[model samples]
Target chain A: MSKTLISARGLRKSYGKRNSKFEALRGVTLNIHEGESVAIIGKSGSGKSTLMHLLALLDKPTRGEITLNGHPTARLRAHKLNTIRNKKFGFVFQSFFMNANDTVLNNVILPLKIAGVGYRERHRRAVSALKTVDLDDKRNNKASDLSGGQKQRVCIARAIVNDPKVIFADEPTGNLDSATGEKIINLLFKLNREKGITLIIVTHDQDLANKCERQINIKDGRIVSDTSADAEQDDDGDEEIREIIAESEEDDDEDATPDKFEGDNNIDGMLDQKHPVHHINIDEDEEDL
Target chain B: MKFLDIIRDANANLLRNKLRSFLTILAIFIGSFSIISTSAIQAGVNNFIDQQVDSYGGEGYLAVVSKDSFDALEGLTGAMGNGNSTPIEYKEDKIQDGMTPITNEQLDKIKKIDGIDGDSLVEQKSLNISYVSSKKTDKKYLIGAEALPPGNIKVETTTSGQLDLQGDEYQIQLEKKYVDVLGYTEENIIGEKIQLVVVDQFKHTQKTFNVKVVGVIAPGVISMGYSYVNNKTADDIYTENTKYYPAEYKDHVVAIAVNYDYKNHSAKEIKDKLEDIGLSAMTIDDIIGSIKTFFDVILTVFKIFGFIALLAAAIGIINTLFMSVQERTREIGLDKALGMSSARVFLSFSIEAISLGFWGSVFGITVSMILGNIANNIFHAEGGFLESFPSFNLATYTIKDIIIVTVLIMFISFLAGTLPARRAASKNPIDALRYE
Candidate 1:
């Protein structure tokens, strides 16, 4: 019943000169509706990332027609395209591309900063996002100090902090262990269900593919199969993911030494509220406190 | 992105690469340092020369000499062309004929010319003076007295116009160092009378007179230590010394000069009138202007060397910014992907370049000013190398020139940054993100 948010027709992308030219995507067509959890599953060199890039407006296809909210975006100027990208779309890459020198809160708040949001409001929202991911206690830690799973969590927080209409995650838990991977999946699914945001995930993991409501299989730059799951939701899967998150939370508490918990108690007090009251300013020095 | 946010991001990025940023700034520092130092030295030298010239010459004055003294051979040739058949008996008086002064008739004639407001006669008579109250009686000082045309003589006076030499009070001016020879303090020697023995060159006899000292003047590079006699006293001595000379040679004035208001008359017109009457006039401005022109050429040459250094520094900035663009390809791509416009990205890098110029010039000016003070102490020290030179400064700092150099360097840095900023702005976001 959801309206279509983005639709692409006859998308084509090629690389290099005529004699040495290689095609990445060939006449691929697809439609993604709002509030739908969709996954594009493909092997290596199958152009799932290329399709994601075009849909996100991060690139221009060699030959294609793309429409967003009923407006054709193929001829839109760069600034307008960037505006759409900044306001409506959020991306989480497989590599967890975070500024190593910046604090966890700063990494989460960068999009708002770029969007020219006020200092106090962005700080509040960044803290709320971090708390949702259960990393509010580590908001002041440098991004480099975080473990791989924790890094991925920060990336997710950054992706959702702006409340975008759609979230594009490419192999969201590819680098984590099974327990950490399950925790990431639970966070992503919680955001999708709670916010009603359209979620598009590209992954080779079949277990991750089964959780989505719809799946598109791409091979050799073509869609081989497009299938949709039944209306019956996976209650058992949700319960199992919740159990994994609970065990990880217990482990996180055991490892939280006195030094790590210094300012964390104050953070927990702020996050305990449905909405934080004190408007903290988001700056480099404010993170340490 | 907002302009302020872009600037802040640029600052943070530069701070992350502190060593590279500092090294780039050092190159600009060297360039600006040379420019500031050279400009200071030039200003100092020119300022000193201007002060020296002002003190050396009274403003708006002209100098004139007797036509015979100015054109000695021409007058003699004209006098011989009168066609007297008898071969003139050439004796001492005949040998001194060409050295005659401007006659009273000539002075009266000049007074009637247009724009000739007033005239004065400079008496040229050699006299020997001895401080009468001094312990050293054997030392006699040779002095010359004259009513010199305003610009001809350069004398530095400690107390100007203290004595009216034309008044009947028979007074004289003594040199400042006469205190040492007279064996008395400066205050004590003011009212003292000194004996002068006038030795006439033509008459070959000495006549003695005593004149009271009224004021003191200092000795300088141009004017050595010579005492002054009042105008009335000078006339009396001149009449007595030449009393036995031939009647025809008796009434000649030493020199005849005229004064005209500078505001009313042009120098060219005055010079033209004087030349018509077979006389020449020299103005102080003409002499000073010619001297300054010589120094200006030397200053221009020094400035060229500073400009060359700045040009090299500009090239260094361009190269450094290009390298930074290459190194931060992925970062730029991320920024673009995050919703930064191409203009904002260009502006961010441009601001970073300007900041480099700002720091370099600020440091250059500060360090140069400190060094200028140190050099001032060494070169302008008492009895130092520059001591013999009057009113000389080793370095002089001016605010206007420093601001100009800073602006020029910043402009060059901005121009150099444009190439790399454009390259960054025009980059394809997908390609940049894939830079790896």
Candidate 2:
């Protein structure tokens, strides 16, 4: 719909070295346009997440060229890159990634705080962002007190608080129940449609990827296929995606995708164990009783 | 980030672990408290010594006496006394054995000495002084009034507000007890006439004269019985009284005030020169110098203890800050990911350390000042708990000293925080984010 917001060419990321060198992303080239909704989809360790990270500017690629809004970022200094990350991008993670001890409002205000906004202005903007996510009444509550879906909503609010040019959600709804996950996907689509914010998601959920206008399937550290649907008629092309999903499900039993969790046995695992239930279900059960 | 925002962030981070932050501040507190308290006490003692030295004939005047009389005056002034009636057994040693007093020839030799401005004869005649109220019969107040050379005596206002002495006034600084016998307050005693009767026991003849009281001084070592008189007037009175004395007693002078500009000549040089001329000289500075050395030694010992406590506190700061960095790993990563530069991260931690030092020093100084004032109040009350000791403040810290101590504490804290801050700054955001 618009000029390229972020473009990456010949991106590569490898772990270990020499004989043990294992590449997570190899020669990935993609361009994401402004206000576009794109999903990088693959099973675990298929280099989809690594490709997203490369586009997000969270890590330096071993070899690549990334142009952000037509500015070459290959040689930008770390501090300059951090400024770009703060002012131009926002990120959401699978585990909600909220600071459990801080208030809901502080969680959303963090990006603005890093941007060095004054306290009163930060408070006002954070409150407005929370209201956008319908969490304004819970502004003073610690993140630990929020339910899983609410925590994800808070993460979205934080991601949009700086009003960045792009939002990166890596498995944003992976931990939520199906109904809640559907709501979160709808929220991401609504932001893309209403606010004209670019949305890039890394996920394996076929149902979620079929909703986007563009879907790139990564397999064995390479792009196996790129598919696009008419923006107003993405549902008309979902039948084809459903067939593809059925074929992948048959292959799931024999799935041998490399375990991304093998070396990633720290953050994601720790976050998952930190708050599994969110206790909202138990509270609802008590209310039912 | 702006510098103020960085400080604000650091403040919030420190609050995350309240107990650790408070403990670190307390360590700095202990160190600053000891240093401030010791400095206050040292300042108090130094102020007292300065006042006492000022009260004793301070500068530019030398006490010229015989080697024996020099020793006697040193004993009279050095010993702790109220300076009323403690005579220096002047009749026993040299005078009874027929040794000649300081003669006019000796005075001329001193006046001719290089660097000598002018000299005056000190009237050492034993005079029985009495306040001339109507009733005065058998109470004889023996006082020694010295007539100092020109420009040697400077009268300063005492607590009772005595008037400044004018030219050629016949005045006496009466003893505290003696003034009380006359039923006159120190302020009212000015311009009152006092009778002085010089008695020559060998000749059995007494000469009497009346002198007007001018300035009143609290009796101390320098002036026994608050005794100071105008040089010319006392010289005239002495000459009048000695008109009938025999030849042996006519040339008898106990001491002389040698008026050398001592700024060019050190006290040691003057004392040595006088000794060459068969005389001895002493300055108030020489005596006070030794006393100052004693106080300085005590203060040095106190400072050593304070420094040791400070060293221990510095170690405590290092320990606390290092632990804080370790615990705040994830938080630090979050800040970096939020676009905080490594330099800002480092500065934030450093500012936190400095703030810890600031609060510690501020609290320590405030509490110590309160305690010091309380102690001083106790020591200054009527018949104070410390009445047996000399009347002086026990602790007094100046604003300059307080500022210096606070800055010193902050600097040490900043230094102690450097290593920990560097560690936090150099932490890889990826690894720190991965840290649980």
Instruction: Name the best candidate (by lDDT).
Output: 2
Interface DockQ of candidate 1: 0.26
User: Candidate 2 — which pairs collide?
Assistant: none
Give lDDT: candidate 1, residue B390.
Answer: 36
Alpha carbon lDDT at A232, candidate 2: 21
Task: Please report, as a residue range, the 10-residue window in candidate 2 chain B with the lowest summed lDDT.
Answer: B127-136
TM-score of chain A of 2: 0.79
List, residue by residue over B318-402, the lDDT tens digit for candidate 1: 8877888898887688778777788877888888778778788888888999998888887767877775443566688888879
Error of 1 at A196 (Å): 3.1
